[model samples]
Target: MAVAAVTTKRKRTTARPTKTQPTTNAKLIKQPLPAGLPREWYETHNRRLKAMRLAIALLDTGIYHPANASNRRIRTAAERIGIHPPSETTCRMVRSLIHYAD
Candidate 1:
């Protein structure tokens, strides 16, 4: 005796796709840094800012856990957010920021 195979059809939705809003190109006003600050301090400050931006971008993209924020993934997020590609150190900083976020 031969057995017959059965197939099931999947249902499709007729909902229309919504248009995504375009991103704004607003420029941020620069604040002057205080004089006499060490060069390392400036570097660290910028690194922290970039990391924070990356962390927020990742969070916006549904990556709430730091474990899921690998370097490549973080870089991709940065690209999506229109940021320059971050360095290895900056990627680590972004993960740390995500880990410490409440």
Candidate 2:
């Protein structure tokens, strides 16, 4: 008696295509500042600068009491200079300017 052999073929699996975000290949170049943007940037810089200057003045004037006093003064001065609710970056700079007497 001869036995019959059965062979099964395996199916091949194909990888699914992945979605990709569209991207630009052009080199990035900074465009010239618009007429209004430079002035706005300068004004912002001026306000932050004024805040720093006032903080420095406070330090120089011997008003480092409670530490926060100078910080508050800095905030107030910033507002007085037309900057409302000063940025944390500017405030941090002001805080860093403080010096303590040994």
Candidate 3:
């Protein structure tokens, strides 16, 4: 039985489906007002409180806070803040900041 199992080879007949990412239309997603912020704020704003706070901290320390920054968290925060998706350059900058953080 062991010899037969070792001699046998299996070939895949169909390709496995790759992981699909969730897509959301910025227009469709609901933006909730964060405490102390304005209703129209999301319309004009791009960054979230955490990102804004991080930006402030970065200005003082000249570094990003690792604990607060994550790719998903940043996107999620932005979605909550509203406006539209960030540019590729911005995303790259934020991700790079994460590495320099902590």
Candidate 4:
């Protein structure tokens, strides 16, 4: 007597595709100011005034605090004179002015 040969078949499996969902809620993060100022200030003096205003705000808010009181007063004077005070990182940029003497 001869036994019949048995055959077995293996099944192939395929990976299922992944599904992605869009995010509905996301928070925006504050970023640093761009490299240059806005174009509204065509005159150099106007740009300087704007810079002075920003510097004053920064100083008042303690963003650039720990600075010497004398330096702060100097910066305030510069703001009043339409001369934008230099940034804290470049405080040396401010120029000195002298009145005419007889």
Model 4: per-residue Cα lDDT at residue 99: 11
User: What TM-score goes with each of the models?
Assistant: 0.68, 0.34, 0.28, 0.24
**Backbone clashes under 3 angstroms, per model:** 0, 0, 0, 0
Clashes of 2: 0
For candidate 4, list the clashing residue pairs, or say none: none
lDDT tens per residue, model 3, 1-102: 799999999999966544342334333446575878776676445544444544444435443565555555556545755634455445456655555554
lDDT of 2 by residue, 1-102 (tens): 233334555666965443342235645555564575667697766666755676665566565643564556767765655656556666665665554321
**Model 3, stretches more than 4 Å misplaced?**
1-73
The segments of candidate 1 whose C-alpha lies over 4 angstroms from its true place after superposition are 1-30
lDDT of each: 0.85, 0.59, 0.53, 0.45
Question: Which wins on lDDT, candidate 1 or candidate 3?
Answer: 1
RMSD for each of the candidates: 15.8, 16.3, 12.8, 20.8
